[model samples]
Target: MQDKSKEAAILRSWHKNVEPWTRAVRESEIRSRVAVSDAAIVNAIIAQSPKHVLDLGCGEGWLVRALADLGVTAEGVDAVAGLIDRAQQRGGTFSVMSYEEFAAGAWQQAVDCVVCNFSLLGHQLVEDVLAAIATLINEKGRCVIQTLHPAYSGEPYCDGWREGSWQGFSEDFSDPAPWYFRTLATWLAMFKGCGLQLEELIEPLNAESGSPASIIFVLSGSSRK
Candidate 1:
């Protein structure tokens, strides 16, 4: 029941704060380092030419739309109803459902790839979510996850160069979401525990000032023994 309340709060927050800024932010970032990282992720999977792909926590379906434009059959899921409505209105097949509610067998025996862009970190039960993603992937399938750098996660930073104290905000400000700010080592271990092998790690140039920015992980699932 506590988890349910948390999830509900997250969904409400998304509707109130995050969904309103989704399109503009995504469009602007798409032309910046964020887009470069996204392209790198797509490139890694292009070699396999996956037939079915799932975009978890897909907001406004930007990445899903991009994948579809590239001719990949993609479906998206998000917990926020407003985001899902917008995504579907844009001709995308998206559902307002949490990863917890997703059925592995409903999609297929397995999915070729699962792309989680700036999502899934906030859940209190992150391990369960990761495990669910592992089950959703086909053997040797790919999983791409992108998240903000640790320095920005719950770190005190001055927003303005003028004289002012650095105010603190939650790391997962995007959705009023709850996040466990794991270090790089912790993230790697989480994936490994879910039976995924790290294939590539790309750090994007900071969109704010071109310094080293966010981290993206491209992982491949291991065959069941």
Candidate 2:
């Protein structure tokens, strides 16, 4: 098990250390090249026709803004207050909250769908967040998770829980957070632990690089044991 206090401190550091990073993401267009699976995610959510959606760990609430175009009402929650504040400045309904608090029943609003995006980081935090989501959704709700491809992680490839400045996306930002790299099996198992069944999985390929840019999992609540 990972310490919530430690993860909370790390999250604050990430938000405190990266003001410009959040700004860039907040101002970025929906179709930015760095947006690995924004289109796919939005499409998937639209296809589901969810009335109310939840954006867990939604940094700056870009997805919340985009989802509005499809007429799907959404709210966002993040551990970083600065990020939440910035997201609110953009006319988004965001709350400054953490996974630990959420799992402990902080938020009472159950949603029709939940999207984790690429913000689900850390080993224990990931499982904790998934477990929280399980109790925060309606009976037929879905979970949309987009994360770095398992095939593109590891030694010499920047895998596991390591701390460093933001280097993969660009050299413009500076922030260090412990990112837990999990295998495909581990990710699927975590979803199962949350009482979610994998309905679909998509590997979004980068058009320019000709390789998978990220992995997206579409899941729904299940009673199967």
Each model's lDDT: 0.67, 0.76
Could you tell me the TM-score of candidate 1?
A: 0.76
Candidate 1 lDDT (Cα, 0 to 1): 0.67
Question: lDDT value for candidate 2?
Answer: 0.76
lDDT at position 23, candidate 2: 56
Candidate 1, clashing residue pairs? none
| TM-score against truth, every candidate | 0.76, 0.87
lDDT of 2 by residue, 1-225 (tens): 455555765776667655676756655633433556778778777777799999988878888999987687999988888888888888968898887788788888889899988777767767777887777778778888888788864434434665544554555555566666777887788788878889888888888777787888888876632
For residue 19, model 2's alpha carbon misses the true position, in angstroms, by: 1.9
